[model samples]
Target chain A: AQTVTQSQPEMSVQEAETVTLSCTYDTSENNYYLFWYKQPPSRQMILVIRQEAYKQQNATENRFSVNFQKAAKSFSLKISDSQLGDTAMYFCAFPDYGGSQGNLIFGKGTKLSVKP
Target chain B: NAGVTQTPKFRILKIGQSMTLQCTQDMNHNYMYWYRQDPGMGLKLIYYSVGAGITDKGEVPNGYNVSRSTTEDFPLRLELAAPSQTSVYFCASAGADTQYFGPGTRLTVL
Candidate 1:
C-alpha cells in the first residue's frame, strides 16, 4: 500500500512564471524515495527536491526540478524562475522503501500561489 | 545542531485530555518519525522508530501513542484526545535517506 498522488489542488504562478506541480505514485517497489516538500507560512517543512528510483538523472535544487517518470509512476515538480517566496504548501512524498516503519507517504497538497 | 526538536510549539486539548508530544534529535539519527498534518491534508503516519526500543505502526495509528527510550527521544502520546486528533504534528529524523524536520506541533482538539 504505497500511494501518493497530488493532482494539483491549487496552483498559480506569475512572478517569473513557470510552475508544474503534479505527482503520481502507486509503487511496486523497485527501489524508492521521492520527495518535494515545502510548507511555508512558518510551518517549516522545506526540502524541495529529491528523486531516486534508481536515479535516471532528474533531480535539481536551484529552481527546484524533478520529473522523474519511473515507468510512468510519475513524480513531477518543477518551479523555475517563480519567486514571491514561491508561496508554499507543496508536498509529494514517498518513503516506502518496502516499508518497515520507514513511513513517509503524503500527497494531497499543492496550494502554491506566486502571483505578484 | 538542533536538527529536530518538537516541544509545545502549540497545543490545545479538551475532548478527553491527555498530552505528551515532545521529540528531540541532535542528529544521531537512526530513524524516528511521527507525522500528522490535517488542515489541507498531506502527511499522515503516526508512529515510527528504528532505534531504541523499536516502535512501529504508521499510516495513522489509532489515537496514537509512542515512545523511543533513547537515540534522542521520540515521544507522542495522546491517550484520550479526539476531534480527529486535530492536526499539524511533525517530528522526523533519518540519516541514510533525507528527513529532518521539526518545527511543527500545532495540535488543537476542541
Candidate 2:
C-alpha cells in the first residue's frame, strides 16, 4: 500500500515571503516518483515539481523547490518570494507500485493563501 | 497541442440518473487516467487505461465504469448518480512520470 500525508490543511503567507508545505509518504518500493500539484480557483491540477526517490538532490522549479528526505520518507515543498498568484491548494502525490504511469496516491492537500 | 480535453464542463443530475464523461487527448499518450476531486480533498483515481482496449480500476471505482476503444479517448460512465457522487472529474494523460490534466468537469447530483 502507498499513502501520502499533508499535515497542514491551510496556511497563509505574505507576499514576497516564503512558505513551506510539509508532506510525508509511505511506500515499500525502492524506486518511485514524488510530485507536488497545485490547484487554484480554476480547479485545474497543475504539476509544480517532482522528486525521484533515487536522486540525492532535491527538485526545484524556479521559485518552488522541494526538500526531499528519502530516508525519512519526507518530501516538503518550499515557495520562495510568495505571490498572490501562488494562492491555491497543494497536494503531494506518489505513484502506486508498478511503474511511473501507475495510479497516483494523493494527500488530502493544503490550502495556501498568499496575502498581498 | 490540446493535451487533454473533457466534455460537459458542468452538469447537474438527479439521483439515479446516468451520464458519461468524455475525455480525449491529442498527445497520443499510451497512459490515461480518470480521477475525481471531492470538496476540500485531493483527487482520487477512479480508472485508468494503458492503451487501446486496456482499462483498469483505480482507488475509487465503485460508482464508475470506463472504456478505451482508441488511444485518444477514454470515457467514464456513471450508471446511477448519488449525492456522494458529486465531484469534479479530471482526465489526465501521461507519457511517463508526469501527467497532463484536462480542465475538469464539475458534476452535481441532486
Candidate 3:
C-alpha cells in the first residue's frame, strides 16, 4: 500500500511571494504519478500540477511547479507570485502503476493562506 | 457539457437510514470512482468501476455499496448510515491520466 504524507498542517504566504508545500510518499514501484490538487472555498477539486516519476526534470505549469525526487519519494509543490485567489486547501496524491483504475491515495492536506 | 453530475448536493439522514448518492458522467469514460472527504483528511476512495457491471472495493469500502449498470451512471448506496458516514462524497470519471470530478454531495448523519 502507498501512503502520502503532508507534514505541514497550515501555511501562509504574503501576496506576490513564493510558497512551498512539502509532501512525501512510501512506495516500492518505480513507475507512478504524483499530483497536486487544490480545493477552494467552493469545494471543487481542481488539478494544479502533475509529475511523472520517470522524468528527472521537474514539472512547471504557470505559477505552479513540482519538485519531484524519486529516490527520496518526495514530491513537493511550489507556488510562485502567490495571489489571494490561490488560497485554498492543497492535497498531494499518488497513483500506483497497477491497481484500481486511476485510484489515487491522498494526503491529509495543507491549508494555505495567502495574505494581502 | 456537464462532464460529471451528482444529485442532491446536500442531505441529512438519521441513524440507520438508507439513501443513495447518484452520480453520472457524460464523458463516456471507462472508469468511474467514488471518494469521501473529511475535515483535515484528503479524499479516500470508497469504490471504483472500470466499466459497466464491474465494481471493486477501494480503501474505505465498509458501509458503502455501488453499482454501475451503465457507462454514465454509478450510484453509491449507504445502508444503516452512521455518524462516521457523514462526509462529502465526490464522484469522478477518467480516461487515462486526468480525471473530472463532480461538485460533490455533502451528507450529514445525526
Score each candidate by Cα lDDT.
0.89, 0.93, 0.92
CA error at residue B51 for candidate 1, angstroms:
26
lDDT tens per residue, model 1, B84-110: 899899999989788979999998999
Q: List model 3 lDDT by residue over B42-104, tens digit each.
A: 998999999999999998999999999999999999999999999999999987687778999
Q: Second chain of candidate 1: TM-score?
A: 0.33
Chain B TM-scores per candidate, in order, are 0.33, 0.98, 0.98
Of candidate 3 chain A, the 10-residue stretch with the lowest lDDT total is A93-102
Which of the two, 1 or 2, has more lDDT? 2
lDDT, residue B100, model 3: 75
TM-scores, all models, native as reference:
0.34, 0.96, 0.95
Give residue B18's lDDT in candidate 1 (0 to 100).
Answer: 94
Model 1 lDDT, residue A110, Cα: 90
Please write out the lDDT profile of model 2 over residues B8-105, one tens digit for every residue.
99999999999999999999899999999998988888999999999988878998999999999999999899999999999999876788899999
Q: Provide the DockQ value for model 2.
A: 0.67
Per-model TM-score (chain A alone)? 0.34, 0.96, 0.96
